[model samples]
Target chain A: MVRWEPGTPERLQRAALELFATRGFEETTAAEIAQSVGLTERTFFRHFADKREALFHGQELFVRAFVAGVEAASPTASPIEVVAAALASAAEFFPDERRSHSRVRQSVIGRNPALQEREVHKMASLAAALADAFRARGVADPAATLAAESGVTVFAVAFVQWLREGEERSLGEIATEVLGELRALTSAV
Target chain B: MVRWEPGTPERLQRAALELFATRGFEETTAAEIAQSVGLTERTFFRHFADKREALFHGQELFVRAFVAGVEAASPTASPIEVVAAALASAAEFFPDERRSHSRVRQSVIGRNPALQEREVHKMASLAAALADAFRARGVADPAATLAAESGVTVFAVAFVQWLREGEERSLGEIATEVLGELRALTSAV
Candidate 1:
């Protein structure tokens, strides 16, 4: 089994984010982040390549879960259905307990143009991965790309709604509604 | 006439791209870029918020031309037609003689994760604007967003092809091919 970092990468991520949100990303140095977590800057560096990387540590796991969700979904599912299932499965990693941090993370990412771009790139990469997986499963060309891309867009819209709903509902529920809306919208001639 | 930046922006952009292409983005510094154009670091700051902005100054012009092209298109044209025309119009701004810089620019942007994200964000914003424009044109829900977003994707694919084709053929040809490809892709089954 691989050794994980002390106190959890998620904890460090939260600390780094609190620092970034409070002091602004440029002003918050890695040394400061390390100090806040009672660790050396060396330790922080050991975990993350740079300051920006702390924000992205869990992306690989997230991508893997999402792809697995798509692949394991019912064989007879529609293109959007498969994608929605994948997004739904990925939501389990984001617990209701972490919604506050999740919102904060989204806010921080939204306010920073560079961070926003990185997030978009990550989403695009995830969509591409999903498309490739779908193609491997015998889905046709172009449809796979469109379904993957559109599915990502629907997830984005749902995530935004979840944030906007302010704890009134879960991402899974919002995702369901968003997917339904997309289907209705697309199906309406 | 609107105020212009006295050729400083263009010169800095060209110098920065050449340096970025040869030395790589991270290896090149803002000071070297300033020195190449016989300008001071202060002057460089006056023109660009940062070094990365040099590669994206034309993006605003592109958005404007695209919107204008859509607006100038036939009132009764389909949404795809409007979007294609807008992209075609924006293609007019591609420098007739700057194939080398264009290639270098694409390469640099492609290599840098941060740059790629910014490009995606810009495209997203442009796509949103197109949707809004379509809404203003009295098109109903879902169709506006889908058509606009799909058009942007088509434009993106076409733009990549144009860049790959290395300016030998006009963007119109590439865009036409992209539109045909999109139609065939979406229309099947």
Candidate 2:
């Protein structure tokens, strides 16, 4: 019989990130995160499966946006074009306000090998999901998988550039630019 | 005093792969691996940092071949061409004799989330190493990174296809074919 509060998830995430940054991800506990936000451990569990999951709260939304973008694109669009469109649409999930938090989050992830592994797993899952989206649109093998993987690669490169200190480019702009480079590289052979 | 044994590392690796396959990766222990090889735990540690590393023994050789291939390529070659040539050369490291063991290894890795993460990390490290090789060759930032990442992608797709049952194509042949497909895909846009 616990009371539900608005913004509890966001509050927990913010508190977890702060504690992880200050005390390190391995040292931070779910209980400490709950206590920081004046909530119980049960409430925190209601939002996140574990302390590590808090940092990846946006993953589901990002995947959904990417898939939906691919599904909604014109059927006549090429695989790479579909991937580019999906990336552009998914870029909206990371608003400007999240930039500093993301930068901190990347640093936290960078410091821990376990977290780095989790990051790679997440990217692999995203690529698989995007590939499935392509398949659903009747795109065939190899091309679908390649385009999806390339999309994830573009997102990764663009996200890093966007997170750089004092960088002003939007995620969409950077992703498009990176995709263009990929296309140019692929075509160069 | 420890008796030096010839082929201790290779024997331990073979024992580890067999045990990991028969008993499962998580259920297998370092002590068991050492016992199976009639080697001391100290000998095992001298070869591998941990049990997980045994599955990735070829990674160093693979990276060395990739980097050497890139270095040996003509300076005027395009980034994609350099990457393709590197992948083709690196393919020589995975001969037909290793196919069955590789297949088993991939299955063991596929069944475990932690192992899958390790695989992704290994691939990411390879890509980073290739990118560094490109940079050493005087290639610029984004292009070097993009080409390296794309090369890894090509290798992954080709490797999977080459691993299919009844597949007779050599790794180099498969990689070259995949690279050709990538070129067509990119040029189609």
Best by TM-score: 2
Task: Report candidate 2's fraction of native contacts.
Answer: 0.72
Q: Which residue pairs in model 1 clash with each other? A: none
TM-score of 2: 0.93
Across B70-122, the per-residue lDDT of candidate 2 in tens digits comes to 99999999998898889978898899898898899888888888788888999
Give the distance in Å from residue B30's predicted Cα in candidate 2 to where it truly belongs. 1.6
10 residues in a row with least lDDT, candidate 2 chain A: A4-13
In order of appearance, the predictions have TM-scores of 0.74, 0.93
Which candidate has the highest DockQ of all? 2
lDDT of 1 by residue, B30-80 (tens): 889999888888898898898888888777788887778878888887776
Off by over 4 Å in 1: A1-7, A18-37, A73-85, A91-98, A138-144, A166-173, A176-189, B1-6, B26-43, B70-85, B91-101, B128-148, B165-170, B173-189
Error of 2 at A86 (Å): 0.7
